[model samples]
Target chain A: MNQLNSTQLETLRNDLKARGLSLFVLKDELLDHICCLIELEMEKGISFDEGRQIVFKNFNSAEMLRNQKKTKWIYQSKKFKRKFKSVLSAAAVIMLMMVGGVEAQETPDGHPIYGDCELASGFGIRRDPIYKIKRMHSGIDFKAKAGTPVVATADGTVLEAVSNPDGYGNKIIISHSGEYKTLFGHLSGFNVKTGDKVRKGDIIGYVGSSGRSSAPHLHYEILQGDKKINPELFISK
Target chain B: MYSKELMKGTLKTIVLKLLKEHEKMYGYEITQKVKDLTQDKIQLTEGALYPTLHKLESLGYVYTEKKEYNGRTRKYYLLTESGQAEATEKINEFAEFVLTMKFIFNSKLAAE
Candidate 1:
């Protein structure tokens, strides 16, 4: 393996610093990773400049910055955990769970389904599709045809799988670990019943325009305790 | 290459398992090892790999050592004793996941 010269390493370090990688640890790992790629290309008879370009092309600065933020977040949380361990009470533990839950969801590890499905509505307040009035949209709506398979986003046991003629139609809520729960609403039918253990990506139901829906779509919600969060946070793009 | 979505959840376990076997490795070597082990089917991007590594370190599952090689310094990571236990737990969890997936697929086929 070819070693990068001091001048070359300095240049790479400056480049990373300019890209907003202020975290020293992440900067070091990324610098080494890039250098290794460049060295391999150099072994293939590529010039230093060309190897640098080829290696840099694989990186997205924005994504790199996001990774840095996530790492910092986790580090800070660990520090907080250590600081509070001696004084931890029931209330403090719940607060830590909330903090950990949000940080843990930095990536969409358990996407509900495969294939492209247009997002009809996002989380937060929006014009109600059926009522035509602004209301809180507790979940994200993905426009899918009726009978499309809706999968669970994480491994959990079913909390509810009931049919209704009015609201949500046929809905299923899977209570996962870490005090997190996922709700898949407006389904045409259920593949699993209440109390069934379902893994991530298991088909929980089919898309349908059940109760209070204007069209066929999957309304998905991620809940931390009783509070509903944006489903988009857990849906891998 | 395997889809990023499919590989996302497994990177921590993979890295921990590798460290359990190899004692210590650096960022670049970890990527190359995964590529070689999976026959180039699972390519780990640096964006995904580094955060996972840092998380392991923060969680006390691993620790890093800096060494000079040639003109520059290289960082090597190795699992802590607790990390060894974590590796066993993760590997078993993943093995059970595989069984669950197989059962789901087989039952689906039977239903059809």
Candidate 2:
């Protein structure tokens, strides 16, 4: 298995680009993978062209990667779409149900719930004890006495921290890596402001009944983009 | 050989869970690891592995760092915070699935 000459590697890059595998990261990754596979095959007495063919064959359809067709594959028939959606959603539901049983719940890469607080409410729709009407609660509320320090659930850059705000009287929103954004709502005071970088358990505010609420609580929400998933999905209680 | 169709649904979960246990891994290392663990019975073709890893990267569950090793560039994958939580959840769920399969299989064996 000879190392691919720079000229051959260049040709492969152009071929891949012409086939719609253009993202540098994706291209480099695939290039390395294919080169390695080809080397293995060539070591077994196959020529480079034959090795390349075998590699492409194992991938099933390098031709299908051609730019325009890549789009088509994603937006194809409704039948394909339906089947794909069911498989993904099934996995999601299973993930949610199986979380609490393991010690891996510590989430080695993420920060734990900050500043010790008790759960006032969990996520989901419920009869609002305050307004006496059914309402969808987008986040979990932790019972913290007024002025108890509220901390960031994970490391991130503060998106906003409002003081004496309306509706949500005091709120702090922090955006973390990996598409995560956390909101600490109805605070008594602000310790961090917009654009401030914070770490896990960093004090960002104080608990209070500042917003439209009935008691001193920290309204904690974890969002992936704008989608509000259950916070309990990620953090252990 | 393992059924490719059966392997399809679990590949992402497997990759995420793998990265969770190790600090970082390159593309070929993951394939070799899976194959070794499964005793060559479950070779992950790059076709199956890379797309899944790329999808996970795009979704921000995992991210990559590139380094030069022995005159070649290798891309190492690591779990982001979200990826860590996701891997935990996915692995737990997969364990439950395998257990359920075993239970069903045992009952059928007894009945037979």
Candidate 3:
């Protein structure tokens, strides 16, 4: 592992403090990741001056910081508190069942449903490609030109496919078994409706820049129970 | 880059020495002290410093206390018992390294 000199270390320390990162709160791995990124950028023909600028640009941006802060907050949020209680309750029930020698229920398969469209934008800090200010892009954006096919990401029953003003334009939410749910947002139009049984990769809607969007794209998300894990974790690159 | 790398290698020593003398420090204050003591030769950035502090904390070499100042919360890091022992070892090691390098360089200069 490459180590930084005292001077370089000091520079890094100041930069992080300026960006509101509490040194005491940061884990070693996260710090190593940031250092690796800076080193990589430096290797990419970028001067130290330019590398620092780019690194700060990427790390200090509102979108990225917001997500980082949100992740931290989620771990300390009321929602997490409630979920923790529920998990404890469920564990107690399961333990009682086990003591009674009852077989535990089997969880359903979680094969991912492929989308019918191509990607437009990824989850991260990006200039709204339309709006100038930084916006928290909560999901992946897919390209399915207006009226082009958008498909379900998994085997699920359509919970809602309707037009609304939340800036998702026309959107759909599917609830799969095992508390796994998928959302397809910013559609130009929809081909399914509430309570509709949809198979994996089934066409459900078409992409459009609807409610609060600047252009045509589908905002996609996957949720397990109530927690939103990174959709890219499941999607094929 | 070489100088930076060398400085980084001895960071534990420098931090331990400072804490041994001053007792405790927050992130910003530590960086400032390094810069001042080095006569501006060394400048630690926040990006690199926090991670090191955290690593030290995880290793039980240091501990932290959160304090409020200027309406903002700041975490100050202090060396632990193990950290003090390790710091002494590091200082000895560094001193030996400097002496050996100086001897080698002096011999080369004399031969030339």
Candidate 4:
């Protein structure tokens, strides 16, 4: 195998990092994989620099970025699942003693509504976009152009799909089983009505500035029982 | 080569099966093996392969260890016990699916 000299390896790493592969968890693996490819090219009588160029051309930055996002999502989801499993085991033991039975439900894991859209604002206390006063932000805000289709994060029945000019501008709340519900706020229009059953990824509304004063975006919330949880935990690219 | 859609959902099973047989393999080795096995008919790109490998690692189906090789770090992936079980399950499931597909195609041919 043709070995990459230290300088050549450094150049390869820099180029990949510059292309946004630096933060990826599999960064070292990818670098090594690319190096192996370059070495194979070199064995074909190609110089290291020429081989590097040829190998680099095969990597699409956008697609590679998508892969990085996907791997990160899988890692987080697995971690969450592990944590949830332990919690469930403890809860089950307590519930069994109390009620002599337990009902298990699947947690919601959903594709991002805007497919890796920019997060304009996140959950928790932050300056209110409207008033500039620090307050609890109920949901995460995703920047989207007006009229972008908003999909249901999980299969559920629409509980409230109403148009109002107030707090959550044209909002829709879908109540899923297992005491879970999702709210879609700032929609331009609704695709379903109250009591309509929608599957995961079903287009339920369009992004708009119907209620709150802001640029076009989607305000999304995930609620378990009566308490709101961070939507970022369940959403993935 | 098959369209990406045709290859969809098989990458994980393929990688797991490969790891199960090989005991351990690196990312590039797995890709090269797939290419050779399929006679260059199915090429697994870096974009598809690495993410699947990472997902498997996260799911506890595979574990990795870094070793020094040729003055650079090389990561090798091997199946966990659960990964071994999963590989058998996935391979069986895929085999059954292929048989069903063949049955359907054969029936369509008979009808025609």
The best candidate in terms of lDDT: 4
Go through the candidates in order and give the clash count of each.
0, 0, 24, 1
**Which docking band does candidate 3 fall into?**
incorrect
Badly placed stretches (over 4 Å) of model 3 are: A1-24, A27-237
Q: What is the TM-score of chain A in candidate 3?
A: 0.48
* Candidate structures ordered by lDDT, highest first: 4, 1, 2, 3
lDDT of 1 by residue, A98-185 (tens): 7887655422257675555788889999988778899999988899888888888877889999987788889898888766888888
Q: Which one wins by TM-score: 1 or 4?
A: 4
Model 1 sits at a Cα RMSD from the real structure of 23.1
Model 2, B1-112: lDDT tens digits are: 6687889888888898789889999888899899888899888876567767766775678888998643456799999999999999999999999999999999999999
After TM-score superposition, the amount by which residue A39's alpha carbon in candidate 1 deviates from its true location, in angstroms, is 0.2
lDDT of 2 by residue, A132-201 (tens): 8999999888887788887777777888887655666798888886577888788988888899988777
TM-score for each predicted model, relative to the true structure: 0.55, 0.46, 0.36, 0.58
Ranking by TM-score: 4, 1, 2, 3
DockQ of candidate model 2? 0.10
lDDT of each: 0.85, 0.76, 0.68, 0.86
How displaced is residue B28 in candidate 1, in Å?
0.8
Which CAPRI quality tier does the interface of model 4 achieve?
acceptable
Sorted into a CAPRI-style docking class, model 2 comes out as incorrect
